[model samples]
Target: MLAFGCTWLYDGAMSRSDRFEIFLAAPPGLEEVLTDEAREMGFGPVTAVPGGAGLTGQWTDVWRANLELRGAGRVLARIGSFRALHLAQLDKRARKFDWAAYLRPDVPLRIEATCRKSKIYHAGAATERIARAITETLGAPIAEDATLRLMARIEDDLVTFSLDTSGEPLHRRGYKEAVGKAPMRETLGALFLRQCGYDGAEPVLDPMCGSGTFVIEAAEIAVGLPPGRARRFAFEDLAGFDAEAWQAMQTPRPPRDTPLRFYGSDRDAGAVRMAGANAARAGVAALTKFTCQSVSALTRPEGAPGLVMVNPPYGARIGNRKLLFGLYAALGEVLRREMRGWRVGLVTSDGGLARATGLPFLPPGPPVAHGGLKVTLWRTGPL
Candidate 1:
């Protein structure tokens, strides 16, 4: 027999009256960074928790969050919760809850359940009861391949449900179909740029420029382009989705006028080509320049000094460990000699490698888990 779990219950069309708790997922150790972004984007009264940030908002906020926020992995809307000390109690409560209010009878449903320190300890049994209740009561079909996902967590005799409002992770910003080795995620790139005090008023340079993630992100921010503009979200599939309102909300912000052009350089011709193509797809081609050149050949662009950001090979995943020291030292020497007034933000897993740069980095930010390695952002004032 298939076990089941339940999702959110809403009264009707999502409106201001349908206020709920929203969770914005983030990378571990970067919760505070995401919080700052949410607050700046006008999303809170926000609070940072272990995995992400939380805020109380209505359905419009959820739509705006999916449309605008650049740092969240996905948005989860808390539906409701109840106490179910045992499987029987869970079955009864799930059946009686108003599943039909939010879930459509025709749309297939998928549920994930977790249990911790609860008398209804068997997650499978709890899931089965809830699933049965929804299927029997609401007549919604259950399918593993369903795009709409509901999460039910049972902790300390309390079962809380949340609906995943974003389908794909926000990092897949629907652009940059091409990526190089160990490319930085677009979400992390945005938050890191924020951490480095980049506000899109100045140019950005990435010497390694793996697929031009940082350069494109900076250009998009400068032009006031919403990150989710190119993609569809899971929220569109939910009941009460206002298609007209969402379309009106996405009316493009007027492109800002800036004289600066973002820059990226790589020794690999293929990487340079890939980065250029990605920038074009992201609609920032005119504001970005990619060149095939090594770090040794990198030069300060012809403009006011700006931020120099790079996520180079961490040796754990990309290059030889011992030889990377020379690369970092050489990068440090180049920046110190040529880029006198520029600020720098370097992301790497090794403190020693960061030290090898010999730049006057103030201090390292919190470690961020990326691709099985804990990476930290090392920043410096004007060089």
Candidate 2:
């Protein structure tokens, strides 16, 4: 599987403006949605791959993606690649790699490796080789707990090196200090909202909102707030990061004066309180409203009809499987009876539970991995 005459090696003298491959890690089943976002955001030559979206961009594009894109779960910068059939070959080539070009010698790094369809079968041994090479050749210390990670993927006898530009998963979003059980991730919520045709122009409501993810995300989008504005990234520790430029690029955009309001309601008063606190931390409390109420009490907010997005309790994660059917039926009945012109997007793992809602759902979207179960987004036309 080795390509004997081809090599993509990093040059230490390459400037930040030089173009290279950047991969935006996508949540399972959400690659297309992310690709569309990257295209709309003007990332060039974007393509949807198996697990992520691939694009060619400069360092600034990397920074902008980490700062702006909502659907991307993480960003990886693919610096270079080489052919290595075995451990000794990997060691030989890795020791000669230009690690100093991107990584700071004073900063600690963690190496992770994956092996597939290659002779270098031991991921641990491969990681040890790469780590030792970086330490001996470039003086970078390897650490287990370091936020900056260098990922090595050995597939088809090719060793490709990528830096995890995002230290933590993008879902953290830095504002959610409190989360309820089975909370939906902000990244996944954003993608679902995109699939539902939400463009920040209309109001949003979540009946089973946990931690107010949907409500806060919708509000932030409406107000033109970037998702990564409240957080730090691993790219700041790279060798060539420009703090002044990054700060300048992120000069806060005055939130547009959106008259729209986002809403979340939950039966658990504690969840409601947590959602409010999270909204406050995200700087969107003024645009969001949270309440403690059951699904039966859900009423249409006074405004133009918008999307009603919900992630209800599924049997696998929440409570008794048999009892959730009644809950689903009740939710369906309420939307049909009360929400006459609003569209509905329901996320659940059990098709039976989704069907129990009795909503005239269009075809379901791809199954997404959530809380260890595959959940599908079920959508319906205006009810």
Off by over 4 Å in 2: 1-14
Clashing pairs in 2: none
lDDT of each: 0.87, 0.90
Candidate 2 local Cα displacement, residue 156, angstroms: 2.2
lDDT of 2 by residue, 341-383 (tens): 9999999999999999999999999999987899999999998
Question: lDDT by residue for model 1 over 24-61, one digit each (tens)?
Answer: 99888888888999999999899888888888888889
For residue 141, give model 2's deviation from the true position in Å: 1.3
TM-scores for candidates 1 onward, in order: 0.94, 0.96
> Which portions of model 1 show Cα errors greater than 4 Å?
1-16
